[model samples]
Target: MNSSSSQIDVTLTVKDSLLGDGNTGGGRYNYTFDPDLIHVTEHDTEIVYRLAKEDQPRFRIVNLYSTDTRDQLDELEIREDGAELKIVHRNTYQQLTVVSLLVHDTKHDHPVNCDPQVTNDPPPVGP
Candidate 1:
């Protein structure tokens, strides 16, 4: 039987950051998906990642982090307008799981040209 029940928030967003990881002493490092980058304080360090079509439900990674840390590590706030990632500590990844932050890539800002038709090998010659 389909019964209607009260809807509760199963997952939390970046806006609810203050309430995140109180005991962990830190919060999830928030990331946004939009026109990026805005320098914060001089000491603050910023890292950027481009989430391709494959990287979806981006929040899942953060949730996995929370569970793995046993809630000791808190989540940081990530907003579209936010260009900086703030942390109470040096902001090292401890058991954090995410790939391709694009730190070393110098040409990251430019859109990637994905040509399906381009083949590395030439066509075979007919007999």
Candidate 2:
């Protein structure tokens, strides 16, 4: 498990125009992941999720949950004062896993929901 195999950075931005005036709802925000879909390979020992510098002070990842718990992830940790998540995946058989991130907005004192996808499918053996 090479922890340094890959690193993913996530960013959060708000669409003020979509929210209209004086609205602080979760719908206004957009969460963008660098690779969007994380593909865990055999060499991957750890997967890290971090907030972009611009969004670090504004939001924090409070909790994370996977839709399928069995054979998807071995261990999960929320670190860096809830600004990052470290995940260890042992089973590389699962095709798709949806990880839901519970985020808290420090600026607005509200909660936001974000879903990220993870897959352990091996690369095509041959054409």
Candidate 3:
């Protein structure tokens, strides 16, 4: 979480294993998002999601929407090339926001749901 910059870049990559086993038709591939918890500071204004493997049949960001109505996002733009998403945040009071990503696995033709958190509050200290 770079407090100096107004924009944050989150890289999304496919995980190694499937969600289920052969019983579930091989299942959907899981994903790993760098900076899994987006610590959006007061100065941060935007979030940019980029694919880890460009032009690969692994995963594609199909749609993005806020699970919570009180989310801080002001705008969401999916790029024309289906490569990235530019999301602008509404800087109001501090709160935790949940954003869902509908990712399409081009290789398996499956849809995977990814929920990443955005928050202005500092992460809790360890035990």
Candidate 4:
């Protein structure tokens, strides 16, 4: 499979209001791409969410689901570190689809930068 052909683009944005109150805040993130352009089952991809250094311990994931079906994708496994959130998918029969993620935090009074990166791993070598 061609790795470049299965690349997916993700967009993440935080509202200014989230930076005004330290109480509770949330943001919506979306992932989208042309279904015809990528063959999901043939590629393995990971979505990495990295938080700004200072915001590492402040923010947390509230809920994440598919916008189209409003249901979580069972194929995804989430891993979190002090500053990074990683979502991994090895092989899925489902098509590469759109998804929405919600992140909530208590230390939102300060600007919290979140960067998302998508990496498609090459399939395992065969005999």
Candidate 5:
């Protein structure tokens, strides 16, 4: 068997907006893909956020999706402008807000539904 090269992983995380799961307010969904060889089917309220392994924006909400709450990444898009290096995301189910910013993953940001609050203090180290 042989492996493949030149692939990019698109991690899609979806969550339900209503019917709070009692203890939790929402549910999560996830999908992974390499857009170079596949078609991405986006819902009417979903959007895409592309980041480096270190959480830097490589591409933002360029090809914005329109579903209630979904995310997808697809194809190699050639840039005619110098804007792909910025951060982009949908603050809502509609419209986009691109920023030169970085966001820590919130419960709302995870398909696993974990909106946790953390202190800046790093974990205790051995003395």
Candidate 6:
């Protein structure tokens, strides 16, 4: 398949309500995307992924980032099982309105250029 089509790009925004809850030890949030759209391997390391917030909060006390590691950062964990991607928030609390998740294979020498437009609406609540 083509390089651009092989890339996986997803943007997520937490609702205002969820953002508020983030202040009080945020709970685990699950996000699922189509596995068929991108390639998936048994090993998690095959996919190079990065997650970040589109807008930063005012306070530095809270930490916001995406990780696949379990209980590493303030008990914050992010797990990926095939098509499913789970987000966990630990000790720190902050509002993450806009989230950008990019995933692509590392085997390719050329960069995967898939930049989706930003949206204000939050991602769906359920898995």
TM-score of 6: 0.21
lDDT of each: 0.23, 0.65, 0.67, 0.39, 0.25, 0.26
Off by more than 4 A, model 5: 1-3, 22-127
Model number with the top lDDT: 3
Q: What is the lDDT of residue 14 in candidate 2?
A: 31
TM-score of 1: 0.18
lDDT of 4 by residue, 10-41 (tens): 33333344344422233322222223232333
Off by over 4 Å in 4: 1-15, 18-42, 67-75, 81-83, 90-96, 108-127
| Rank by TM-score (best first) | 3, 2, 4, 6, 5, 1
Compared with the true structure, what per-residue lDDT tens digits does model 2 show for residues 1-127? 2123544444434333354432234356666666677766653346777777777887888887887656567568889897887877664464678887787889878787777767764432124
lDDT by residue for model 3 (1-127), tens:
6444678889877654543632222443556678887876544378888778653456677888784465567778887465678887765556777788777777767776777777764323124
Output the TM-score of candidate 3. 0.76
lDDT of 1 by residue, 1-127 (tens): 1112211111122211354542221442233333232212111122222233323233222111112232222334443322222221112332332221211112222211111110011112124
TM-score of each: 0.18, 0.75, 0.76, 0.41, 0.19, 0.21
Per-residue C-alpha lDDT of model 5 across residues 42-72, encoded as one tens digit per residue? 2211222333342222222233322223222
Error of 3 at 54 (Å): 5.3
Better of 3 and 5 by lDDT: 3
**Which regions in candidate 2 have their CA more than 4 angstroms from the true location?**
1-26, 122-127
lDDT minimum window of 10 residues, candidate 6: 54-63
Q: Identify the leading candidate in terms of TM-score.
A: 3
Ranking by lDDT: 3, 2, 4, 6, 5, 1
Clashing pairs in 5: 43-67, 44-66, 44-67, 45-66, 45-67, 45-68, 46-67, 107-114, 107-115
Compute the lDDT of residue 53 as modeled in candidate 1.
32
5 against 6, candidate with superior lDDT? 6
| TM-score of candidate 4 versus the correct structure, residues matched by position | 0.41
